[model samples]
Target: MDSRRSPLGRAALLLVALVALPAAAQGKKPKEGAYVPAPADQIPGYSAKVMPCEIIEELIPPRVNCEGELLEGKSLRELAILRNTIFARYGWAGFRKPWLRDHFQKQPWFKPNPKFTYKLLSDADRKNVHFIGVREQSFTERELRRMEDTIFARAGKVWNDVYEWKLKDGRTVRSCAEPQDPLDEKEGCTGANCEGTHSRDCFFREEKWYRPDPKFSEDKLSAEDRIDLGLISRSLGSFASDTGKLEKGAQASLDRVISVQELRQLSLRDLRLLRNTLYARRGRPFKSKILQAHFKAMSWYRQDPNYTDARLTENDKRNIALIRSVEDEFGGPLKDEDWLIDPATDAA
Candidate 1:
């Protein structure tokens, strides 16, 4: 006789069915915290046991553990996503924050390893990581701004006391100083050797020297100024590519005058200064047409494609007219006097 068909067995079977059915289906509601895990394969990985979500601390090239052993291949970004997914699926919320922080601090992408870091990445890893974090929405705007400021501060410190000199041999040398003689005191002039052929003067007297003004320390520079200084330092070589024709000090002077914001605000005098500096560097006339073309190509200029004399302010119109007049003259090489002569006076 089938036990399930008996009255007592039937009652037990009914009780089991009632308990197993979802309460809502039985005309009642299920309580909260009744989550059930989906199948392991339903998670992102092919096999959850061998998911690509492990990080080895202090590795030269970052390694991940997809299975039993740590292996190198995936990027830190890829590993981060895998770890985030694993933590979310496994309900390891508590581990995610600390794990992300530690990973960000130590990862080769965030901080370069002495041996394993790429040459291109050595100086730019922080910026690269910050950009990635911003793109991934991992960092807030305020957090990114703070990081940017910190980077600027560190860079400013590096350029603070730096100085550059152009030797008579047409080579440039840069160094950091702290109110000390560029040469050692042991090399100082003695009366006996001061006029001698082997004197210290023999080495330095012929070479040109350049140094930061003793009064103008890095701390005295505005934040914008420091940023400008850093940019010039990085781009100095590129700017001085035509140094063969450039007069002494032209590159350094141009460095002081050039900046994105200041370019838009350049007065006629400023433009003249820039043109003269370029002329001195190129050993050729710096034409007004070239200056106008350069100005038109600036980001500020391109921001308004419909730019015309009608749109220009009175001062701007005057500046434009002055530059154009100089270009129209097509006289021999331009001289400093050419800029000093007012266009209005010539028109009259």
Candidate 2:
């Protein structure tokens, strides 16, 4: 039998009810006012009031327009030049010296100012005078002639004015100055504080020996250091504030280091949760390198020491594999072997 009544049968019943029922009751509408939800008795079936559905366009927003940070032009060239120079001259250890040995040694009697300024000097007059050092000090030729000679010989025409002439009374005096232009009466072509046509070409080779700041200035690590370490990304800073263990509420602060995708894929509870396992196994925080580390750890664990513990399981491997697979799909950076695995232990 049909569950619904026929239209003709329903129409006849409706006509009869209309004729019998009161017009005042049928015409009245519910009052509009603020009130609590309908009581359980008042509603039929489910009592919970559900809002009507709203239609939203199925389209997703365009991907973010952020451009990845670009490296500096000059910085790249300078780094290449430095690398080439280092390769040519031993390694970084050999390149860094001089400043570490003797930082700022000055001749004791070097002159700060000359007794008389001369626009022009005869060959004999020029030979007699000398500038031993900064601060108006003078040094005897016998004291530092060998060292001065070595410098002049290496520089060639670059050290024409540099000389340590002998004085009367067995006291030797040295100019310790740079080679000056004989024709123009200008300072030496290349030496301390000497600037002229040829000065611009002179590189500050001596200054390179100064110890550079070990801490990263910008990216928290130089490109070379990152490359060498096989680190996909440099750490923002040391986790020093919390000391050995992460402080309470520090996990939220460290959220910036781990991306949302990483958090979703990995079952990490908090910052401290990854302390021993993550750091010891993975070393540095590389997006997907943890997978390889996990695999390596598993292989080792299947052996003697780890197998005896009986804590290793197939579930753990599955979870780690999922994390790695998702990380790969997301295209996050992975740490190189140098960063993810400790060389002393995992050299192979």
TM-scores for the candidates: 0.18, 0.16
RMSDs, each prediction? 27.8, 34.7
Q: Which candidate is the best by lDDT?
A: 1
Instruction: Please give, for residues 1-348, the per-residue lDDT of candidate 2 as tens digits.
Output: 000233344344334432442222245442353112223343222112211222111211111111221111112112223222211211112111122112111222111221111211222211111110000011122212233222222333133333333333433333454334222323332333334322211321233432323341323333333221211111111121211122223223332243334333221211212332333232333234333223232212222232321342444344345444443333321233212111101000
| Clashing residue pairs for model 1 | 246-281
TM-score of 2: 0.16
In candidate 2, where is summed lDDT lowest over 10 consecutive residues?
130-139
Residue 18 displacement (Å), model 2: 88
Candidate 2 lDDT score relative to the true structure: 0.24
lDDT of 1 by residue, 134-172 (tens): 222222223333343333343332223234433345444
